[model samples]
Each structure stands twice: as structure tokens, then as C-alpha cells.
Target chain A: MISRMRILDGTLLALEAEGMRPTAARAAGWRRAVAGCGIDSLETLLPPAGAGDSPDRASPVAESSSPPGNAASRRSAAPERPPSLSELIARVLPTTVVPSVSALANLASGAFPQSGWHCIYGLGDALFADRKTLARSIDSLSEGREALLAPCFTNERGCATALAVEWLLGGEDRAALVSFAGCGGLAALEEVLAALLVHGGLPAADLRGLPELTDRYRRMGGGPIPPAKAVIGEAIFSVESGIHVDGLWKSPDLYELFPPEIVGRERRIIMGKHSGKRAVLVKCGALGLPVTADLAERVLQKVKEESARRKTSLCDTDFIALYSTCRAGKDEKEEGGRAVL
Target chain B: MRFCKIVDTTLRDGEQAPGHAFSLDDKVFLASLLDGAGVYQIEAGVPAMGRDEQDAVCAVKDACKTAVVSTWNRLTEEDVRASVACHPDIIHLCLPVSERHITRKLRTTQAALLRQFSRVAEYAAGRGYRVTAGFEDASRAEVPFLLQAAETAKRHGIERIRLSDTLGMLRPSSAALLVRTAREVGLPVEMHAHNDLGMALANSAIAVLAGAGFIDTTLLGIGERAGNCGLGAFVAACREYTAISPLQARKAERLALPLLSRCRQRKFFT
Candidate 1:
């Protein structure tokens, strides 16, 4: 079902903007990851030729093969450089068997040939426009051609993700322009995919490859993803509050809309200042530790004190140590009472 | 121009986030920044946490020149008494409205819970304090019961009714419906959104569009789970729908960086 929707990802462009060299290997890896996530296309906007210090040195083609000679003398002989962007795209395009490759161009410029490139219009004040106005804009600019409306992430009007999803849900057969992890202020590929699945009735498996894609994104210098980011945050499934833990224990549907396994994640119970005795007992049970009423109470008290003192949640090691200490204390008190008896 | 009041809870709910413990100085500084950013209200803290917390709340109250200062409390006389000692501009009493929270968490029936809420709101109002009733987890509550609870708040002379999406489980459509339903009670509705689903900003924006008068926010969206709706993000997202000034938004954005730096310096996420 996701094949019916078109998604254009601009992760390579984002990487280049972050000062990472746009190598053939990085592009190929990105293509594989995007394809694995069921995305339709990969979009990149390379720097204009001759913009970098040494176009030849930065070119992936040059990196692959060069005539054996003194590099300085060769450069001095002819200071001409090939169209590196075209060469890089050509090299990377052949490897993407699933998703097609496209170039990025600004809607205002109208210079780049629109045959194989996606034109992006900046949604400035239009972000606050009603659905009718936005539809008219999309239809007028698209003009029977595929046009991708990109939101100005710096615009103080609204959220880029919400705008993109609104457009996608409202438009008919309109392609979405996004970037992995929402880099470069474009809509995030993962978040949009999750929204489509939730709102558009797309198949759940469409998002099953997120955990792997997340790993690849980080490996490709996409920076650390926020742990609480929507749909793909690593710690989104982790619960800590007393009421929430108890509710999830009673019925997961009471708290979670979808199971964590839908995104290849698992539920985690965190012990912190807000944790209660029920959480301690559940955590102890999960860890295969013996739990008594008094022990659970004492351990919870210790957890709250320690988490408050450290200003952070307790790790498994810290929880285990506290449990052991409480158990030992209980044993000591019992022994002292026996001596008195 | 339509105006949506901004209530910044960075010092209260934001500090409830795991790994985030703001000292009195941090609370005072953040409160001043939020006030400078033109927030209408600041939920300082829970005074019942002890003398230190009460002192922090008072310091934030003193530091704010424009914003109204408020304190969060449970539906109990003891909590209200503690809040009164702080002398905040408003006292907010949180009552659980959902069946799951009321019966399972609080172990009480809906009627009993409503009675308790009425008693607490009346008690706080009788003390000559402006009182607000917060319906914790109202997103999951039955619409009829939620409306009834809203009526009870209005009957008690409560100034406002806050609908808290405690679990952050609402999408835009559901959020709009909840806000619309709550607005029918003829009392001002405030939306306190959480970001567990990453839709807090979207939900808050929709709530404003759906006739809610107040929106709750925290700096950098820091709160218990994913966090509350972010002050900067919400202002940016709802600028068209709300009367929040662009200058104030820029000021809030500018202050957010230093708050982030402070959190980073303290290694809040570590």
C-alpha cells in the first residue's frame, strides 16, 4: 500500500550541508536504507560545480580512478573540472534499484530543467492558509506536473510536520518531499510514514524497518536523534510514572495506542523519583528477583531518594544494588531482633 | 485579534521530568525568562513538596513582574493549605476524571470524586484564592462525565478548567472534539498537552483553533514523559491563530538556548 504513496527523501543533501563529503558509498548506503523503508525516491541538491576548494578532489568519480602521475603537475596542466554533481548522481543512480533518484531545485529560480528534478515551493505565509488556498497554490504551481511543496522550517507560523501531513492528507496524488530524521527542516520521513499509517490506513509493516533505518541514519552522520522524538525515538516506549505504570500493567491499551513491537521497539519501565511500589515490584518481577511487601517498599524509597539525589533515573545496576541493600538490611534487623529475643 | 493565553509550567511540570531537578535559582531564572517572553501565567510548583519547594515557588512568584503566579495541588485540604501558604495568584487543584484513573488509581467512584473535587474547589475559593480545576487525563474520560465535571468547576466559581492530556494520547481530530465539547460548558478551557506522540504542538494548535482560551507550555517541551507542548514551538506554530507577539516569540526562542545550555551543563539527559 505504501507503494501507492510517493516519498522523496533528501538525506544526502542534509549530509552535504553538514560538511560531510557526499561520497558514492554514503549515497549508495542511503539509497539502500531508504528503499528498505519503502520510500519511493531519493532527492539531493548538490553544491554548484566549482563551489568547493577542489572539485576534482571532492568528486566521487575522481576518487575511484585517476591516471597515475604527479597530482600537482596534472592539476597545473589543466584547471578544468568535470560536472561533478552530474557525475556523482550518475554513479549513485545506478545502484538504487528500488527508488529512483531526483535532483532538487528551488521553485522561485525556475532555472533547473524540470524533467528529472523536483521543484520545491517555500510555504511561508501559506502555512497558515486554509485548505482551499493551499489546494489552489498546489494546483496552480504544479500545473499538471509533479511539484513538491516544502515548508519553511524557520517560519514562525506552524510546525513543518503538521503542515506536510495536512497537505498529504488533503491533496490527491501529491508527492511528499521529506528528509530522514527531518534534517534540513523538511518533514521527517519516519514521522510522515507513521502518520500515513495511522491516518491513511497504510500497512503497519511499512514502518517495521525504522529501527534499522535509524541506525543507518546515525551511522551516516545524521546526528543523534532525540530520545523522545515521535514514532522513532528510542525511549518513546519507556514509562516511569506511577499511575502510567499501573495503568499499563492493568491494560496496555489504556495507555499505548499501538504496541511497541509495531516499530521494532519494546516497552521499558524506568525507576525514578515518580516511581511507586507497584513499579518496583513489577521491575523486580521482570528481573527475576524476590519481592516482598516490605522489601518493595524499602527499595522504592531508596530508589526515590537515590534518583532524586542523582537527578536521574536509576539504571538496572543501581536498582539491583538498592534491592540487595534493602534485603540485607532487613536480614540484619531480623537477626538483631532474634538476639534480643 | 483572537488571543490564546499562554500558561508556562516550565518550573512545575517541566521539573517533573526524569533527570530534571531545578534548584531555586534555576526556577527563579526560568520564571523570569518566561515572564519576559510574555506568558500570561506561570505554574510555579507544588508547595506541599516541603519548605524548599515552597521557597522556590515563592522566589519565582517574586521574580515575575507581569505573569500571574500559580501553584499545582491535589484535591485535598492539606495540599490547598500548603498552596495558600505560598500566596500564589491562583491555586490549581488537579482531579482525575477518567474511570481508569478515578476507580483504579484513586480507588473512588465518579460521584465520590466529583464530591471531593467540589469540596476542594469550594475550600480553595473560600480562602479568597482564585481557583482552577485541572481534569487530569480528561482526554480518555467519557464526554458526559467530563462535561459534568466542568459544570462542577463552574458551580464552585472556578476561574478556569484545564483539560490535561496526561498520557499524550490525542491526535488532532480527537483533540479538537475534546476542546469543542469542553467549551460548551461556558467556562474558559485550557489545554495541557503532552508530547509522547510527538503531536503536542499540533494538538495545542488545534485546541486553540477549537475555542480553547489557554494553552500550557514548558521551555524546550521538558516534562514528565516526552514533555509538554514547547513554549517556543507552540508560539511559532499558533502565531496565526493566537495573538502572541512575534517579538515575544523571538524572546522566548532566545531564552530557550540558555535554558538548553543550562540543562546540558547539568547533564540532565545523562
Candidate 2:
């Protein structure tokens, strides 16, 4: 049978109850015994001397806190020591209950091994209902440059709300990263977490609010950006039924969590079935087309009709030629290069 | 400085080159050849490319003994999952880090792209598989973006970050600078040079000198477009630059030439 060790039932219990370590408790008792009225000698604190000692010898005061030639000290120091478990739990519990979950996280990672103490912090299981406790936990966790891993529960509700709030407060990088098990219920949230996990963790510097933060997270998550997955959605970026390719090229801060350089690719406006002159003019002008809007529109109409007949997207060369003719200021009625209008 | 891993992507990217095809026998033969050549890694192919590619990757998986076999993927979870079926020691996912490409092709922001890449990287890492992130077309990517990608990959627990000159646009000096930058960004760098400018070998040399531990190459420099730098040239160059005894370098140099000849005979000439 496996033996259970209890640290609370021994003489060490009173000391432990006062939040003192076993070694400290022993030293305190030894000091008291040494100074006491009746028990002036350290021997009073120690077990009785046995055959191992000379009969006429006076026991050393220094040896009193230490176990003598008896079974007591061995049992006390053994892994199965009675009060160890409870003492350990007590020590850990208080630290774990610290409002700063972030610090607790650092302790777990052994990041601050020199701290000489592993803090006891809350698991956030029951404390989620308490905002003050939750806030405290977040503060504790975010205190140092330590990383935090959010422990996921059944509903996955606690971390999601906490993280969302943290992001809004510009605490995205400092917030605990939700565990991967939480990915399915909150796809978007998990996407953010997944991205963070993938890229290792967000750089503490570039972290920001929801749209930008989530956008950054989604890229690292490596889940296929669905056609409609918020900022990364194919549709969110592409212009629909319009000519402008849209948006500034650099300074992702304005665009929300991105510049195009994240991928070795660029945007190209492709004229298609729904092409119009204004759309053509806008695309060409944005990309530096020299053509008039009216002429560009006429050519775009013809190109659209041709693409519809052929059931294919307009090729780059075709679009280029059409744009070139319009920009060349050709007459609308000219035979070879006339604008379709 | 303590450990250097030279990964050969001959089988994977080489196959992607036009006019290059390898049968099963060819794969086993090449893998055995690579093993004897002391390559630390061999990227077989993207497993999900097709049944044949997957089978080839599996065959490589079974054949390679001394080298860690790996496969390629996009920075996506599905790609990683599919690539795992081949049982490689590593899965290499490519992400584009240049602003032009990110804006024009992906139409997404770098911040977002990085997030996606990180998620997939961690997922792959969590599965107990070594993961390497390839910054495709890294030669043209802005310095800040490239450094960020490298740093990000390091944080995500990737085994290495490969800076690929997808268009083979970098010179040796530039390649060296990038490799050094990658090291400064705190990443184990790998160089994937193409011969688009006929300087693939030169660039590969620069990468190594700049602290790149891995260099992607093909047998006899066989890859896309102008092909990659000749592997033979690289081994020979290392023999010259490394701080080893001249006698040892001479022997290595001599051995590499014959090995190069044999590889060409079997892989191309034959």
C-alpha cells in the first residue's frame, strides 16, 4: 500500500500554522529551550541520550535541534514525513492564490529559479465569478516578463472572456495564452491563441487591441483563413464590384494588425465578369493608370462582356492592353483601338 | 557553434523543378547516397501533394537512417497533419515574409500572417515533431519583416528558420548578411538558395560563413529555373574555409569531388 504523508499532526504543526518552515520552527524551539527557566539546556528539546553517548557526558546544546540516536529524526526527514504534504500545500496555496496569475505562471516554468520560493496561485477555477479575484490573478500573472499558459476548463468560458478583456485593455501579450484544448468552442479565440502559440508568443512590444491583436494571432495560428474569418477573410481584403484594390500599402497600424510583407506576395486587381469602367479607372489610377475614367470604363465594359462569353478571368496581358488603349487617348470610334463605348 | 545541421532538400524541392522526376528506386538510391555524404537532413516532399509524393516521402522515411527525413508544408495545420503521415523527423512550413507578396498575394497583414505561422509552428512542436519554418522569398523581404519572422519562429519552438531565395535574387554578400541577421534574431538559420542569378553556390557559402547551419541544395545543383547551387561546390568550399588541418581539408576536398562525380553519374548522366 502507498503511504500517505501528513505534515500537520506533528509538533511542526503549530509552527507550520504560523507559516514557518520546518527548519525555522525547529530553530525557534531550540532557541526557546535554550533560554527557558526550567529547560535551560538544549537536551530538553532532543530525544534522550542512549548507549552511543558516554554516561558522564553533558549533551551539546548545538545537537538539541537535531535528532539523536533515535528513529524520530529519520522519519521526520523522510519523503513520507507527516506534515510535509500539508505544509507544501499551505505554502503553495497562498502564493497560488495571489491575484497575479502571471507570477504563478513564471514559477511553474522555473523561469525565476533564483526567487527561492514557488508561489501558490489560484487555478482560476472558482475565482472566475469574482472579477476582483480575476483581475488580481491577471495582475499577478502579468507582473513580470513571465509567460502564462491558461488552463482550460470544461466550458472554456473563463479564459476567453478574460483574454478578450485583456486584449481590449492592451494586455494581449501579457495575458495568459489559452490552451489548445480550448480551440474548438471559441474558434476565433483559439485562432488567436493558436497563432500566438505558433509564432512562439507574441512579441511583448507589438501587442495591441482585439482586431489587430486577433489579426496578428490568426496569422500565426496556421489555420486556413476561411473566406470570411474576420480581418484575414478573403472578402474583407478584396474589393467587391469596385475598381479600387483598396487600402494603404504600409503602416499596418492603420490597416489593423498588418502590412502585406507577412507573406511573400502582393495584391493584384484582376478585372473579371463584373468589371465596370469606374472599377477599371480606380484600379488603374491606384496602381498609376494614366487613362481617363470614361475611356477606362468603356474598355472595361467590353472586357467584361468578352470574359463573360469566354467564362474566364481576364488575363493580365488582356487587361494591360485594354488599359493601355484607353490611356493612349484613342478616339472612341477608331477602328483598331476604339473604346467599346 | 557546438552543433551544425546540414539539411539537404534535394528530393523535395528538386522534384518541384521542371524536367526532374525520381522513381522509387531513384529515391532509395539517392537517400542512401545522401546518408553516406553526411547530410543531417533530407526533405523528401510535401506528403499531401499527391499519392505519389506521399509514397515517395514514405519511402524516404523508411530508407533514411543517419539523416533526419523531413517534408514541406504551408504554414497550416492541415498541411502539418498530412505531412505527419509520412513519419518524418521534421515538418518544414513556408511563410512569406515580404510586404509586397503579403499585400498582393495573401492580401493579409504581416501581423496576421505571423500569428498563423506561430500557431501552426506550436501545434507541430506540441506533437513532438521538430519543426522548421521557411521564410519563402526571404531575399526580397524587408529587413525588419525578415528579422521578425526569424525571431517569431524561434519563439514558437521551431527547430530552424530557412531563409529561401525563392526567386534566387540574392548575391553571396547579401546572403551572408541575411544569415547573420537571422542569427542575431536568435534563430538557427538555414539557407535555401536558387541559381536564378547563377550564384547559388556563392550565396550558400556566404550563408554558412554567416552562421547558417543548414543549406538546402540538390545533387549536382539540380532544382527550379537556373537550379540551386551545386552541392559539390558547397562541400568543397566548406573544406577550404573551415578551420581544420590542410591535410584533412585536402582529403575532404578530394573525396567530395569523386562523390560529386558519382552523384552526377547516377542522378543525371545515367
Winning model by DockQ: 1
Per-residue accuracy of model 2 over A131-230 as CA lDDT, tens digit each: 4655554455445644232222122222232233223223341222121112322212323322332233332212122233233324324233333232
lDDT score at residue A123, model 1, on the 0-100 scale: 55
lDDT of 2 by residue, B104-143 (tens): 6567899999999889988888888888889877877899
- Tell me, what's the RMSD of every candidate? 7.5, 26.2
RMSD value for candidate 1: 7.5
Candidate 2 at B201: error in angstroms? 1.1
| Every model's DockQ | 0.31, 0.01
List model 1 lDDT by residue over B154-210, tens digit each: 999998999999877676667889999999999999999987656688778878878
Q: After aligning candidate 2 to the native by TM-score, how far in Å is the CA of B116 from where it should be?
A: 1.0
- lDDT at B174 for candidate 1? 75
Q: What TM-score against the true fold does each predicted structure earn? A: 0.77, 0.41
